[model samples]
Target: MELPIDHFRLLGVSPATDGQTVLRTLQQRLDRAPDQGFTHETLQARADLLRNSADLLSDDRHRTAYEAELTALSAEGEGGQSAIPALEIPNSKEVGGLLLLLEAGQAQEAFEKASRGLQPPQAPALGSSREADLALLAGLACQGAAEDYRQQRRYEAAARVLQQGLQLLQRMGQQPEQRRRLDLALEALLPYRVLDLLSRDLSASLERNEGLQLLEQLVRRRGGLEGESDAAFPASEFQPFFKQIRQFLTAQEQVDLFSRWAEAGSPLADFLASIALTASGFAQRKPERLQAAYGRLAGSGQAGVEPFLACQLLLLGQIEPAQALFEQGADPALRQWANEQGEEPLAGLCAYCRDWLEREVLPGFRDIEADPDLEAWFADRDVQAYVEQQDRKRARSAPLHPPEAAAGAGAGTPSTQSSLDAMPLWPGDPLASGLAAPSQPGQSGALSEPLQPEEDEDDWPDLALGWPNLHWQDLQLAERWAQLRTSAAELLAQPPSWVLPLAVAVTLGGVGVGGWLALRPKPERGQPIPVLPAPDGTVQTGAKPSPAATGAPKAAASPGAGAPGAPAPTPAPPAPRNLPLTVAKPSSAQLRSLLEAWLAAKAAVLAGATPEHPLEQLARSALVGNVESQRRENASRGESETVTAEVRDFSVTSQTPQRIEAEVTLRYSDARKDANGKLIASTPEGERRNTYVFARDGQTWHLAAFRASR
Candidate 1:
């Protein structure tokens, strides 16, 4: 009744049509046919094609049986046979085998079986009773193969499988049920295909705008930016897509893309754009644009947008809002992004924020004891408070005195001639007595005026001179004179007898003794002592005297000690006392000179001068341990290397009478040979402050030790 139907011809496919081709061709024909008013022959042809095509395409065993049957029918047709039996589809058990393979995760095996089953037969016409069921089974097997590829992250292969299924379904145009399933599978795979293309060649995709279009489609399919449709696809799925294409997009393009997605109200789009903005070098240099995009996303109250926005705000120096966002809690994803982005300026900004919080905000919070919220906030970073307290303790412990006071205390008044002159002549002598002498009345001295006035003379005696004026009465004076005359008469009579002669004899004897002593030969002269040279090279012909003898009182010489023609021998001056070495505190000018000379000597050593050089001589004379160390270091460096040092400035940190601790800033340049002996020119410019301890050697200052400071 169906006329020897050629299923392939009816479905517009060749005899060798693959199973997918048969399914596609049959579906197309059915879809093209009207639902109503179709002639019986046309309807019958469509029905017969659906049945035979499903039978041939649904399973390999059924398709083989049908093909053999078709061959027999064809042979019968040549013989002019009138009958053609209905196509027999494989039993459920045969179809179940393919489904079992797919269900057991054996997708490749399932796909192979499905492919064989869908193969077109030699005869063009075939019919089956259960066409819809077989077609659906074939679609399921194709989806299974595609799913296997996807699970292995072989997106390209998965996409290929999905595309093949799509094309097959498209060709079988009228099979709505099978076509819909294939369409959904293909739609699901499109993003991965785009992602694969992007990963392979980002520049090509961007140039072609394929990546952008796919991203838009993905965003739209997720029910616009605002919708939660993205929950269906893992964030990891789109991560590769964004990461691959981020560098290729220009700033404006990124902004436009982000702005469009943001307008679509998709939180995922906003979040991704925020990440891209943070990752971009341009965004680091220009944060305001990023801020606007972030502001829009954050306004939407998205779960992840706040922290990213906070980071951007931090980079922009917007501390308050950034702090608020961070206080809510740090986002691990954003922190990871910040680290991997490798944007130094952004990293620096984060460090600045951390420092600011620790140094400024946290302290303010800690200081507010009355506010529980502030206290609780401070408690989170209590270590910071402890550090602050320690720092404050250090500051308090080493309170800085005024510079003037410290200098004044260290440097007493300078010795002067006036001060020497003002000293007392003897120990415990009063200063006023040594400075000025008391004068007699009517004499020119420090105090020449009389003690009493002329009018007060009668009240007080004139005792200015050694003797005082006697105020005896006239009668008393006469009585005393008469008594004195009487006494003188008595004395004149009794005296001058033995006493005068005794006095004369004693004077004569003293003169005789003196004459004898003077005439006596001096003690036998000892052998002339050998002379020894003084430290200063002066010879002294005398025995080394005891300290007491050398300090003994000198005697007065006799009148005739030396005869007219002979000269008196003079004792050699006592040998000068040996004084111990003492350290002398240098003045400001002397310190400057010492520092300048030390610097010059260092420069000389660095410049490759020999130890015999003038600067080296000066260094040896002025600097001790440090100079020798430097000289040794320089000598060890050999001739191929050269170092030059320039003193910038210096300050005295501390000073003692014996040593000075000074901080000196110096700029050094070094030139040396590499491992291959090739001369490498390198000039590293920076300031170094070294603390040098200078010990005073006599009147000169010598560098004793030196160390670098922070």
Candidate 2:
């Protein structure tokens, strides 16, 4: 008879058990067989099965052979994948459906389905071989799904799913290898999960603290919290990764985090604490913090901090020393370019440092959208902000701006000049605030590449994106921007080399249109000739003049210069009144109210409800078409969403009396669910920056156009 159970399962013992324990366990089971209420025949058969498994496992040769077979089967069950895949299990309707979903590249859907199937009353029995296949399938689905989430930067969800999967597998207990893999995956996700928590909104203190605790645990394994390397994390990536996450915290938070590390009294702690101080200095524009940062670096016992120290010096207006250190690090080609800009050597030096400096050395606070709550919180602090016209009025003052790019050490350093004349302190911006790397279409928030080796040095470098939009400086920023625009337009204007024949056709078509206008026959004199205006802004004339032509009916003598019986000329359309407009506070409030009501209606529409407002009142004209298409697309995927929308940065960029052109950042969040109430998609938060136009009648504005910024 073919027994479906493996030796481990049959014996109810782990592979780790010794041979003596295996045999003793079998003997003990046999002695207690009658307690199971089995008849003599059944008892004997049970004894035989237990004894047979024990005998095979008791011998080293038989145990090794059996394990080899099990390994081969395990590999086959796990799809023999180097990268994780859904476990290849014995076919059943549920398992087959799950696998098919995975095969179709719908990992989230597969994950949801598998999660539901593996829980509660739906979960299969644990004893049989068939049930074990389902168990392994559940583990595989969790792993594969978590991997997909990790790739999408959803580290929190990935770690949670992996942890749950690991616990589930431990309860199932047959596959040691599957359990180990799940544990490893969970371990790998810990650091990313911590990063995600730290990078989120600062108000989430509970989550951030949890991340900190996890971080402390990670360090403890390396040696302790003050160790130079990490156990789970790579040593090489330690500095840059920590530096990136530091920028996402406020100055107060940085100081607090550093204080914790400073108490540890190790070189690693000193280095980490120094990083916090440097970031805090920039965040609060505090000279004391910058000096403290430099002092802490001495205790760090770290090497290669010359560049960072140099930047600190520049910010403090130690121009001569800063300039020397900066130039020493410059590559040969860059040095040549710097030497070439002799007229304004400072400008070129600043551009090179700003563009070419490694991001690891750039330290600052979180760059979050302005919020009323955060503003209120910042206001009560003793710290001085950078935006005020006078820095001396504040309790905290500093040489906020950087030193001049090239140093004469006279009165012209950035730190000595008025804030407006120089760059704003770091809180204002490392470069300039509003003009910082203004996004062009398709280039939003992306860092452009540095100039190619063969590129002309005199031309604007792609890396110097902020230079073009930076209007206040004496730099010809606007002109450079125009040059780039003109260059792009010229490239787009030219026809493809292969499309010469199409160009020929376009030329012929132009000629044909002109010829048609010239060669057309003139209307007969008495055949109801229509009145028309002359191209030279005069009334049309016929060989026979009308009574109105001599100004008898002055208004009627305008365009309709033919006989008085001719049909009234179309009244001259009023001259288009196009002028730029600034959206006022009252208009802003009105539009915001309208948008909120519109979004509520849209949610109903997406959920398959036809509201009484009929979408026209909610989003008429141009918005209606966009709403309808979006609804249809979601519906095709068996999806629906209940969205909450908020608009920001609202402005009326331009307008006519009848039409208002505006732009806004639409912030919304939604969890999209299918017909079965299963989540198909989710965005905790999203922002859509775009411009739209509205047509106005009397009081109501009709949406005329809706489009994204890029």
Off by over 4 Å in 1: 1-123, 126-141, 173-184, 187-195, 204-212, 230-256, 266-275, 278-710
Best by lDDT: 2
* Per-residue C-alpha lDDT of model 2 across residues 529-584, encoded as one tens digit per residue: 11221111112234523312211110101112223353332333333211211233
User: Global CA lDDT of candidate 1, please?
Assistant: 0.42
> How accurate locally, in lDDT, is each candidate?
0.42, 0.48
Residue-by-residue lDDT tens digits, candidate 1, 376-484: 2222333223323322222222212222333453344222111113222222343312223233232211233223111223343443342211222223334423432
Global local distance difference test of model 2 = 0.48
Q: What is the C-alpha RMSD of each candidate to the true structure, in Å?
A: 42.8, 27.1
Candidate 2, position 619, lDDT: 43
Predicted structure with the largest TM-score when compared to the true one: 2
